[model samples]
Target: MFENGIVGSLIMIAVGIVVGFFAGFLYRKKIGESKIGSAELEAGRIIERATADSEAKKKELLLEAKEESIRTKNEYEKEFKERRNELQRSEKRLIQKEESLDKKMDSLERKEEQLQRKVDAVEKQKEELAQKIAEQKDILEQLSGLTREQAKDHLLESVKDEIKVETALLIKDMEAKAKLEADKKAIDILSGAIQRCAVDHVTESTVSVVSLPNDEMKGRIIGREGRNIRTLESLTGIDLIIDDTPEAVILSGFDAMRREVARIALEKLIVDGRIHPARIEEMVEKARKEVEVMIREDGEAATFETGVHGLHPELIRLLGKMKFRTSYGQNVLKHSIEVAHLSGLIAGELGADITLAKRAGLLHDIGKSVDHDIEGTHVSIGTALCKKYRESDIIINAVEAHHGDVEPTNIISVIVQVADAISAARPGARRETLESYIKRLHKLEDIADKYKGVEKSFAIQAGRELRVVIIPEEVDDASLTILAREISKNIEEELEYPGQIKVNLIRETRAIEYAK
Candidate 1:
């Protein structure tokens, strides 16, 4: 039995050894298979990566080639444009040269024609001279009585006499015709200009009237021995005239602006019921500022109404100063506006520059705005103002020449002058005292009477017309026209009158044979 047990144990040991060996071999085979599967997956992934890289590199190369092609195309296009421009410039230069050559050729042809005509005329004159000499010699020979020199002298004397007579008659006819045409045309143009332009005239007084609330307010205004009134006058530079004119006070001053300031200040004081000097001063200052604003506003309004723009700020303010200014009791601002309208109308009718005419007309009297403060005539001052404001040369000339102080250089300047005259000389445009009017009429008559061959002179139609009766023996019928023109010219040069004056010369020969 023991021998059998040992043999079985040995068998068992051997069986265990075999199973262990087989398990070890299967484990080794499974590990080897797993490593092979991982190697295959890594190889597939590497191949995919390499294919994607190759496709990306090919696309990058194609994009680079497209960009290079675009750059080359742009360069070629730019070069083509430059070349085309150069060609065009060359073509233009060649065309201009051709035109110049053509013009020169035409000029040469005209000169040649002129020279040929002159040469032909000289030859014809020589032929006529030779023929005349031959005929004179034959006549001298046939007559055998008079010398050639004597005959020539007789012919010259007769020709001279005929020429003198013919010249006198021609001059007379020309003068008559020219005078008739000029007078008719002038009348037509002036009448048309006057008929087209019409504006209202405004009269301004130096004194301003301010209405008070009651009579008692006057005492407050006077303020304890006129302290308040004196304070106002001193500040505003105007005289306060307090009279028994029923709750109204008169403000008088040569400076219209000052008078206006006083009027405003006084009205404000009365309204506030504060009559002390301190309150008066405050009110005056406020009133002055208000007047300044009003002046600027008036200037702007004038420009707007006249359609004139681009005036300097200083020029506009100066124009406002004319609002309170007066010329022979005519409101200067109104007069300026009327002149502007008249100038524009006349310019339109005459086909002149309307804008320039209106601008000059509006500013023509701007010098009057500062004439009282300045030491020169309004024309000179206005010319200076126009220069300071950089106005055009034409405008400066018009302003300076409107009063005939300077000769007008442009048609617009003439239009401005005519408009100023028309505006100032129109009926009711200005007012004068009875004394001045009488003196002006007497001066007009006196001017006419100063001329020779004047029997009597009468200033008729408010000094707008002058009638002179000349002695027929002293002035002939033809001389009447000359005498009238001379008198008219003398009046224009010597006198200062509104509108144009007519000088009429009447020469009537009276042969009174008394019936027996």
Candidate 2:
């Protein structure tokens, strides 16, 4: 049993040894797998850490690139803004320069206009001053004894007259020219007067007389105890005398027109059945008005014939009244007509205003109508009438200057004056009294006797000239010139004569030694 037990122990020990070895093998495998799993985990941790570090580096590089692009864009924008600001500044400067240039141009234009106005004002003042100085010089020369040229000559004579022979010769030539000019002027004046006055006059002396049909017509005119006659006289300003003469009644009035009115009124009263005071007055008034109308018509007709119009209405009426008037025993109306014709003829010859001249001549004697009633000269009255009627200045000057009452100022005035003289100087225009004739003769003789060497003097040729006898021993040949000049001056100063007078100073030294 003991032996068996020992063998079992040995077997069991061997089995136990096998089991211990297998278990040892399983522990070694588990320990080795655990170590392998721990190494794999360490490698995964190292890979995850490396991946995280690479992602962080990529994000940083991208952020740096984005920052670089923004910085570059900002630099470009700054450059663009600076260029735009510079361009705007340049545009503003240019605009300011343009405005300044325009303002300067406007100021220059205004200054030029002001300068032109000042120049014009200065020129006008200069003209006015020159005119005033001329007027003052003229007045001073007239008031002083010497003329402007004469005073200048006297001042220059002390320095230049003796040394300047050429000047003396020039003065001599100028004096001769001045004398010739004076002679020519005198001749021209005389020729103009003669040409203007060269005309003929046709005088009409008879008044127009109208005949009635019957003397029995006078009874109707003397209606109801002289009521018609009294009315006619009062209205017509005429006296009616029914006399014993056959078929005749006398109408008398100072005015020739008044008598004609009375005659017509009387005839009308006879023709009408009504012959009372009122009817007579009506007929006379109508006749007077008819005559006045006829007078105006005649004036217009005469003006038409002369080709002169545009006279005032009042002038026409006044011209009509002059038709029936008379002057110097001549029919005033005929004289006016003749004067008008003569004035036109002379105006044509003298180259004057023919129409205006005819008008003046036609109306020159218009004052004769009122000369009997008005207290003034006929010429003065005519001038007033002409001015009041607004006649032209040429015509007004003619009427007053015709009779030498006023000086003539124009060619038309001269023509009218000559025409008036021609009308008045006709063959029977005037009659001279014996007293005036002898007085003129004596005055002519006295003028010749006033000379130094005149022993006897006689007026001949109707006192046109004076013939004087002088002793030749007492008066030399040169004394004849002195005597003639003295007589002519006396005649001009003292004698009032028409045209001109001639003075003849004849001194003869007849030495007759008879050799018989």
TM-score on alpha carbons, each prediction: 0.45, 0.44
Estimate the TM-score for candidate 2.
0.44
lDDT against the true structure, each candidate: 0.87, 0.79
Give per-residue lDDT, candidate 2, residue 231.
Answer: 81
**TM-score top scorer:** 1
What is the overall TM-score of model 1 with all chains considered together? 0.45
Model 1, position 269, has a per-residue lDDT of 91
Compared with the true structure, the alpha-carbon lDDT of candidate 2 equals 0.79
lDDT of 2 by residue, 444-488 (tens): 898787766788998888877888888788776544555566778
lDDT of 1: 0.87
